[model samples]
Target: MELEEIRVAVLRIEGTNCEDETVKAFRSLGVYAEAVHLKQFYSDMIKDEEQRSLFDFHCIVFPGGFSAGDYVRAGAIFSARVKSVLKRDLEEFIREGYPVLGICNGFQVLAELGALPGFDEDKPLADKPEMALGINESNRFECRPTFLRHENDGKCVFTKKIEKGKIVMFPVAHAEGRVIFPRGREEDYLERLKENDQIVFRYVDERGNYAGYPWNPNGSIYNIAGICNVKGNVFGLMPHPERVFWRYQHPNWLENPESPGDGRAVFESVIEYLRKF
Candidate 1:
């Protein structure tokens, strides 16, 4: 598909403050992208022409922010809404091999929707959530720069442009970002993630070494910062990639200004995948 022919939907709801930046990230790549209200997908209150279908876009993104104010868990409300109305469509979209990217609060939604750790290939959506992004171990909302080491071994479409073991910095802002699997199955789940090559990114220090606390930020198991599904088409992470689409967005860019930011490679990778599809 042509770059301009590929359309991206940056799905959002009230309190999803990062949609604009998400849209900018894709548009900067010269692809068609827009911030789409969640209601426009299944709400009768919307105008007929305003309604959209999941199949309308080649790729869909769940951007960062406190969706539905993160009232019931970070993404519970939004996930519930999507499950209630658009679950089947979303499942179909995933089954069709279309790309789905989620960031921060968006990552919570995918987990809540049972869309990640998609161990069951036959079932598009897990019967229940297999993991949760809990409150940070610090017990407070953390907002700071974070370094991540790309770990995916060519299975994740989102990180294809990112060299394995390469360290990249993306800022994170969230309270509920710690990733936890079900009790008694943590080891089993982690093993499965590694075996399936689903672990895409791991938190690291400036020197690219695995570290703890502020480096891990949310205390995600195994220092995991991001992951993709078994098929590599669905991806979710805790960092805000859209916020750093350009070198100027980096906190220290003035000292070492560059055109493309570390995060830009993510968008470029996905867009390149869509072009081949």
Candidate 2:
């Protein structure tokens, strides 16, 4: 497939504030991209022309937002709706090696949907969630630029363009971003994630050493900022890559105004992978 031939769907619902940015990020690469309301994909009330299928696009993106008001839990309602309406289609989509991206709250949804740390490819979603993105350790919405060190050893298709050990900055804004594992199985889960090369990014200080608190932002276990499925097609992270598609979007834009922002590589990596698919 060619870059221009690829289609990206940025899934959105009420409270999803980042769809425009996510769409723009893909369009910047000259690929066909648009924000599609979740209802448009399956709601019977939607006009026939507006209705869409999961396979219509090569990539599906769940942009950042406080879906369904986040009353029960971050992404709980949204993921439930997806499971009820689009579970089978989504499973087939992932099975075919198409890309699925979840940013910020979207990441929470993927975890809730059992798409992240997705162990069984034959069964894309688990009967129950194995992990969660809990509230930040600070107990406040942390919205600031943070550094991330790329750790994937070529397993994440969305991050292949980024060099290993390279540090990039992307802003995060969420109250519940901490990645938590159940008791007694933290080690087991961490080991499986590591052994499978599912771990993609880790929060780090300016010097690139793993750090805690402000550097780790949400204080996720292992300082994990992002992860991918075992197949490496599905990816989720707690940062807003679309917001930093351009160098000027960076807080230190003046320091390097001539180059693309750090987040661009993420979008580029997806294009690169699709070009060969």
Winning candidate number (TM-score): 2
lDDT of 1 by residue, 155-184 (tens): 998889998989999999999999999999
lDDT of each: 0.92, 0.93
* TM-score to native of every candidate shown: 0.98, 0.98
lDDT of 2 by residue, 1-277 (tens): 9777999999988888899988998998999999998899888999999999989999999999899899799999999999999999999999999999999999999999999889888887778888899999999999999999999999899999998999999999999999999989999999999999999999999999999999999989999999999999999999888888999999889998999999999999999999999
Looking at model 2, the pairs that clash are none
The runs of at least 3 residues in candidate 2 whose Cα sits more than 4 Å from the true structure, single-residue gaps closed, are: none
Q: Say what the RMSD of model 1 is.
A: 1.0
Residues forming the 10-long window of minimal summed lDDT in candidate 2: 121-130
Deviation in Å, model 2, residue 160 alpha carbon: 0.5
